[model samples]
Target chain A: MNISEIRVLIGDDSILARKQMKDILEEVGVKNIEEAANGQEVVEKFRSFKPDIVFLDIVMPVKDGTVAISDICAEFPDAEIIVISSVGTQSYLKQAILNGAKDFVQKPISSSKIEEILLSRFERS
Target chain B: MYTQLFGNYLLSKNIITPDQLVDAIRKRNDVFVQPNTIAMHFKLISATDAEYVTKIATDKDSDFISTAINLGYFTREAYDEVKDNTLPEYLFLGQSLINDGILSSSKLEEYIVEYQSNNEMIDLELYSDQKDNLDQLLLNLFIIANEELPLYIGKYINLLFTNLIQFIGEDFTPLNFLPCEEYPVSLCSYQRINGVHPLTMYLDLDEKVALEFASRYVGESFTEIDEYVKASLEDFLNLHNGIYNVNLSNESSIEMKLDPPVFIEDTSITPGEKEQLYMLPIVYPFGTINFLFEIEKQETTSLF
Candidate 1:
């Protein structure tokens, strides 16, 4: 899979966060990108868009990223969900990994980290 | 921070008028003592050498110290010695106040003694160099009676000052924290920290100040409060809160999550029934910005 062909989904309650990540992904040659504002939206968008990669935030209004990860992985076991959160506690990290998240990135998100993740995932595919 | 605290003390004691304080701060910002002036004050360089270096610096578009060093007028050690004696802004403000004749030298000395005694502090010169001493002074100034809140609030404020120095300009003075029921905000961005202990942190600024602050953070001259300005302000808050949360997680094993920053315009934010709101006013060259921290004992029930 080429970088531009990868479908990316960003689930963050912050409009600025989503826009920032989208801009970074676009700069990394990601052509198809989708955004969700909450955990419920993340699961819904994952089912509809079936993105190759998902960037999820832990804190949201309707649903959180941790539970959404579990939901998405339960239906689509091959789903590649990356948990992105400002909180980097051991408990959250442990829970996110146990829920089948592929990786974790803390905020404020850096472009290099996104690119590294994207390059690694693309290589695996 | 001590400057603003001392200024407020002077205002409260009727020793200096508000106009005088403002004038002193404005003058303090404009007062830039050149290296030659400092060297002359310390008698490190002769007047003729200083004048020669000044001429060359102007002609070469260089600094006085570098030009003097290049011309062998003064050693680097002498330049460092002169630089070491440079005064901090608070002292500069005091000198400016005295120069303006708003307060006599003797009266200023008395006020300094009283301010130090009331705050149980040492000389201002040492206070700026010592972080622990400055933190102690901040605790004394802001945390009057609160016990637990002071620990978090003090850490938050210390980190805040560090961030302000890192991102924004370092030439700022923090005023004493004022307890207020509500703040009339022109532009405000805030985030809530939820988990074991919950707190709401916000930066409130006047429209013009917000534009200036965003411009400084983004390294762009923003003339208006547009989406870019708003996003920059929100990103700043998020970055600060995110760093604070990471520290808490790494050091204390505490799990606290941050809500997405919300931007509000032309409104007043009121504290909850059980919450206490503190407005920390920080004065910059452009304007003053108030950082509002609201903390409550009760656990947050809602997710948003």
Candidate 2:
């Protein structure tokens, strides 16, 4: 799939975090993007929106990103959910990967990392 | 970091008025380093000698390094090193005050001496990313609060300063501790740092300071304090704690986690059950904000 045609979902509790990721995704020419303020919302959006790429934060209100990742990946099986969170501790990273997250990037997120992920995802290998 | 600290010191010492300090802070960003200022920091030239060199260099329209070297105020070897050296931002505060005629170079020299002697932080310029210097700085802050500095807490405070400079602007200083009980909530956000180092941190400041802080953190200006502005404060605290958690885990295998920030509208706040509240006030170019760290007290196991 082309980079611009890829769908993106951002799940973070902070409005700042969502806006920041949205700005970076737009900068990278990703046109279809969806946002969820909490883990529950993100999981629901994932089921309905079926975004190709998901950015999840660990700490959220009702449900957490780890749980959301597990939920989405369990049903979809091929879900591409990346853990974008501040608390990227050893256990957190292990759990995120084991539970179904594709990659983990610690916050505050940088454009270079986003670009690298996108390039790696869309490039013909 | 020491730049804002020195500015705070001048205000505390009554050497410069609050208005003068704020004015200097607003203009301190305009200050670029000069060789004379670097020489003064190196102690190769006294502040008065620096002043004289500056005057002569100005009148003759000559370069300061060559003028000072010719005047025997600085040796050739000193000139070679000092020419390449840059002044610490700490001196920018004093330089700004001097330019505004609010202070004299000689008086600034005296305060620098007294402040260094008191805090044992001797020279701000040499505070070069050294762990020892950071520990000393944290110890001095604890000394100001009339308490002992624990090593564990020191690590967190050190990371706090590091993250503040990394995420926020460099124009800020951490003042002495503010008694938490005396605080009346204007705008406050709290987040729990859960795990081995159990603590809940709070960021409290007025709405105006919050707006400016949010602007700096997000790199965008907002005309008012709204949800995004509040989220900026929460995100900042969360971000700092998050990085600290990563450091702890990577260094010692002691993993920690952060809770989402809570914005409080209460008139006042107290520590959570079994937690003791400690507050530190940090001054930005915009205004003063407070950090309240509510540490969980250790429980003693009684053998009866």
Candidate 3:
């Protein structure tokens, strides 16, 4: 349950977003990390990597984060998915939470917020 | 912004060359009067006192006002009064243009009157009513191509300038709008807004300008159009479009969603066959970056 032992997955259409999140996660002492470019990739990576935490963007090309969240949650009920999006409308947030996402962070995602989430997850684990 | 608008007007009329416009803009930044000059103008302090204050300020690496205060040359109230009474930006630009021989003082005055009258901003003072003046200028300057689209061009351009000032440096001048079917872009990032109305917004620049822009946005040095540069441009477009959508939603009760930003590298991008695309050129110290908005004519009821 140590921070470095926790596996992390970042699903974002923007390579910049994924890299930024990965850098912050690394800074926070998370060693094992994976990235996906779209919703389909998110699902595929989730099944293959079985990451402990997933950060999913709401908008993508092939599939979207909402469906990805639903599919992952339905299959892995214990999966901890955090919806990361640029759009933070009320309806989007509600739909994300409804689809069984553990939390939501609006983009330009801050490192402090990521650190806080990681710290809380560390404590809980 | 008004300076740029006026410069564009002059350019369109063939009264000033592009080089002149750029020169005037560069000179605009140098038009500020030093504290000694202001003090001399207002007779707030003697020339000797001003010189003494300037010497102390330089030696201490402090500002004229602070040095004057420490030297007991001027009170805080006097300093504030001098600062507030300085010339406005537009006037400074006009004076700079005149000094550069681009226009005579009388011609400058004539043009100012004409510009104000034509734009129906006669009451727009250069300094005191800036926010309102900008609102008026943007509303008057931006011409919406499609009749169906709301008068949101002003709002969009306002938000653009605000964000540019926030993220990028405020040292930029927005040029006149030009209509073109295709732009030879070295680097471009765009996002589509879908909902009650659909539109595509693009940020396009040359590779060198893109590098400088990306570096400015992320506070990092970028020498090439790499993944990080592309992502930074995409993120900027997304961030700006996100704010625009949120504003529209909050103010007009219109919900809109953004598609993930797409980056086009080393290619020319063309507007859709039926879409009306307008290119707004913004001149920065680094280079010119063009913003292209391709808005299709919606067949639905007018949202405005």
Candidate 4:
């Protein structure tokens, strides 16, 4: 996928995590990027950024990714969202997929994970 | 009740050697002597940055942001800024290597799609895998060692291999310690270094279990480390080792060794520095646990 052509939204609660994700996204040639701190923020950013892919955190302060995904999916069923989280439980993974999240990424986000998410969601689709 | 019952159970089972039991305690007192701590001592991060994440923040149940933001180091906005970018802590790079780039690009994309499209909520219940089991055992070892030798250094380590073995019922090989500047040691990616000091321990269990165990130990009952707690911890390791031994008794008669428990005071011991005191780590069911001891004399009740 061309980095400059992809539009992405990043969400999470750890400052260190956000930086790493941003760096990794840029590394994969992603240029149009938006960011959010929680589920609610993701919603706001999702509307504003209208990204091709949204990376949402599972756990957050104002709103969690799960609820946000539900709300966004209800409104924009085509919304492309991924649950970003530190805890990797099977149940959560299943639920995120059910709720409209396109994928999930564990904490200490890796560059490869972001690249994979973008390529599959935007480039392939 | 938890400590004595668990300790005696392991001792009677003969899972861990007397020497290993003692070493566990020593390792605990010297807990602060890890390579990361040593890095702090060497001024890698500011004194504030070097401050170990408190017991609460380190726990599995604790909220990550609450732990960091409560520190008063960063404002909500600043914290949010970093959090949104998904910037990883420097410590996590090592664990990411397993599947980060190893999978084929298409396979990786498939997993990501599965991840993003999924909407399942994670259950907060505690579960055990071989990794969790190993973590539980290592945690017990740490608890037991800390109980016996509150002032001595305790250490744990994990052996790294391309392929991880997770047999249903078998004892695995223990970790092999490399020589350290401090004698005791410890990985995650984006970070690597060596050190010395006798008061550090390391483990390479699954990060999930490590986070869970840390939460359990730090949250319940352990307010400030003291003698009473240390004794109980020693017993915990003893029992845990016994459980571990039973899991592998069919394959080998390998016995873990321990040193006589002792105390430490005043004299400084730095980990990842001073190369003379290194401990070798062996692989267990899930991972490795290793430690080094720094002794001090003190009067205490006999270990009858």
Candidate 5:
């Protein structure tokens, strides 16, 4: 698959955050992208939108990114879910990893970091 | 820390005009200690020579630092050292004032001395970024706040101030906070941090400030309040609280959980029975905002 061919899913309660990430992804030449405003939508979109990779925030309204991560991974087992959040503490990081997240990125998301993560996953897939 | 404090101090003493203070604050980060100014200040070059260096640099489309270095007024290593060392923010404020003709160079020096002595914190230089200095400065800013609020609440406010400069524009001034039993909310977004130190923080904004603040936060022009603007406010509160929780967890091994930020309108935010409440008014150049916070007193003794 080409770099721009992969579909991306962004999950966060914040509209500004979603736009920021979506803009960066488009800038990186990714065309197909889906967005979820909550963790429940994230899980639902993972099953329906079937994105190649997912960027998830831990804290959401209905369901959090941690539980969403566990749900997607347990069901699919091959889901590439990345946890992006401001709470980068040990407990959250450990819980995210134990929940089967592929990686963790801190909030005020950086473009270079996103590009790096996307390229790594793209190459692996 | 000292920049805002000293600015507030000057305002309290009726030294500088409010318009001049606002202009100075907005221009501080844009104007740094230039080489010609430093040369003239240290008498390394005459005032006329500094002007000539500036002219030469402008004509050459270069900077005062490189022009001065090329003119052999100061060595490259000395210029590097000065550039590497950040002058205190209050000094930048002074520079801003002088550049805007609000105060002469000597008058600014006098105010600096007065500010340090009046505040009784002689080590004004140490407050540049030192966290401990901030805690002391916060205590000094509100001498009776500790008695009203609590220990970590001051820390939380300090972190909030830092985040304001980090995320939002630096044109706002945080006015003194007053204790309040009930705060009427206009357009408000709130998030709670619950754990060892539990607190509910509410950001209330009248429509005007909300528009300007959302514009600054999202880097887009927002003239009217909509779902997007309200969501932006919630996101900012969430961002600040998340970073605060991260800091607490990393630094103090204090773990706290945050709920999603919610947008509430036409409501009253009051303190709970065991909560200590306070409201701080922040003045941006565009408008004003009120950020209210209430922290619950712990049932058990504090571990740290």
Candidate 6:
């Protein structure tokens, strides 16, 4: 998905992290943005709003990001999604990548890291 | 950590020798055994309660008296008497120096109360033959100093100091013994995560916050990890051991020694229950360094 053309949805359990991702997206020049608190919320918003990109937290109550990512991807194969987590175990990372997320971000949110990943992936795509 | 902060505050003014400071802390522990132990020896507190306090204090790295009172095992009178009666001069001296000209009689009274509230010393010998009070005091000093050192030195100095503490014994763990007020550090314990006989250290901190420390200067995260930080952390551990063993000098000398530090990359390791977790953030140059430690409990049979 084109970074500028990205209409993104942000979903995470932590209020701090969600806001941080939103601010980072704005900094990166993504204009259209929506927010959600959990995986199910992300799915509902994805179906209704049909954002071009989604930043999802892997560990959340009521259908985690992994489930949400699969649910969204199964329906919207072209949807751009990124999984975020604090416990960056290799398993979680691999699962996220396998579930059709474009990328992943670690928690205690680092702005530079997210920006770098987005720029590298989207710039190439 | 506050203890070391008090130490630096004192050292900057040249109030006490490093040796003297160590002596006071060591004596405090030996002089004031576990209040529960003392209480039990005198038949003041029940055997069950004493054993419970020993476990809580050791596992939590907290004061036996207060832990007992908090647990409702002892009355307020029992906790106060023991806490107030035993003041580690070395630990309090730093605070004394900070308020040297400023501390009034009433303020001194307050410091005494705070000292009672803040101080939490344990006797490891209750379980082991180790008698090196100095070494224990030094270890405590190092942990305390790492937390106490100013931001000018950077907060990572604490991690460096923890590296040094790993040397003090075969294994180490940080206990989350007490609740911290500000810039709380994360509790950490270093032991053979899984072994037959694992040694643990207890740490206390504020659990709500992450581990970050203030920088040397205001409005910055303390990032620099230099020799000063390394040496200071080392010294703090040394003093903690020294103080821990000092008071026992006359009765017996526990062999306290340390090994070299081995740095492990940043990875997540859960301390489990023996090493309770407490967290508090310290505002430094940049961010807070979470302070952490673990406490090893005394066997009920051993306490008796």
User: Which model scores highest in DockQ?
Assistant: 2
Query: TM-score, each model?
Result: 0.72, 0.82, 0.75, 0.35, 0.77, 0.38
Docking class of 2: medium
Who is ahead in TM-score, 2 or 5? 2
TM-score of model number 2 = 0.82
- Which 10-residue window of candidate 5 chain B scores lowest in summed lDDT? B295-304
Q: Please give, for residues A1-125, the per-residue lDDT of candidate 5 as tens digits.
A: 77688999999988888989999998888999999999899999999999889999998999998999999998988888899998888888999999999899988889999989988767423
Q: Model 2: DockQ against the native?
A: 0.77
Cα error, candidate 4, residue B229 (Å): 31
| CA error at residue B179 for candidate 1, angstroms | 1.3
Clashes of 6: 94
The TM-score obtained for chain B of candidate 6 when compared with the true chain B: 0.27
Per-residue lDDT of model 3, residues B70-178, tens digit only: 7787788986776767454456555566668787544665676687676656342442356666666665455443344446667778888878867887666677667
**lDDT on C-alpha atoms for all candidate structures:** 0.77, 0.79, 0.76, 0.42, 0.79, 0.46
Question: For model 5, what is the error of residue A40's alpha carbon versus the real structure, in angstroms, after optimal superposition?
Answer: 1.5
Q: What DockQ, on C-alphas, does every prediction get? A: 0.52, 0.77, 0.56, 0.01, 0.58, 0.01
| Residue pairs in collision within model 2 | B3-B90
- How many Å off is the CA of B216 in candidate 4? 24
Docking class of 6: incorrect
Pairwise lDDT winner, candidates 1 and 5? 5
lDDT of 2 by residue, A1-125 (tens): 88888989999999989999999989888999999999999999988898988989998989888888888888988999899988889988998899999999999899999989988888422
Residues B102-214 of candidate 4 have per-residue lDDT tens digits of 32223322332332233121211112223444333434444344453431122122112111122111222333224344421211111111112122222222343333322
What TM-score does candidate 6 get on C-alpha atoms? Answer: 0.38
The TM-score ranking, best first, is 2, 5, 3, 1, 6, 4
In the predicted model 3, the residue pairs found to clash are: none
Writing each residue's lDDT as its tens digit, candidate 6 over A59-116 gives: 6667877778889889998888977664344555666778888876654456787777
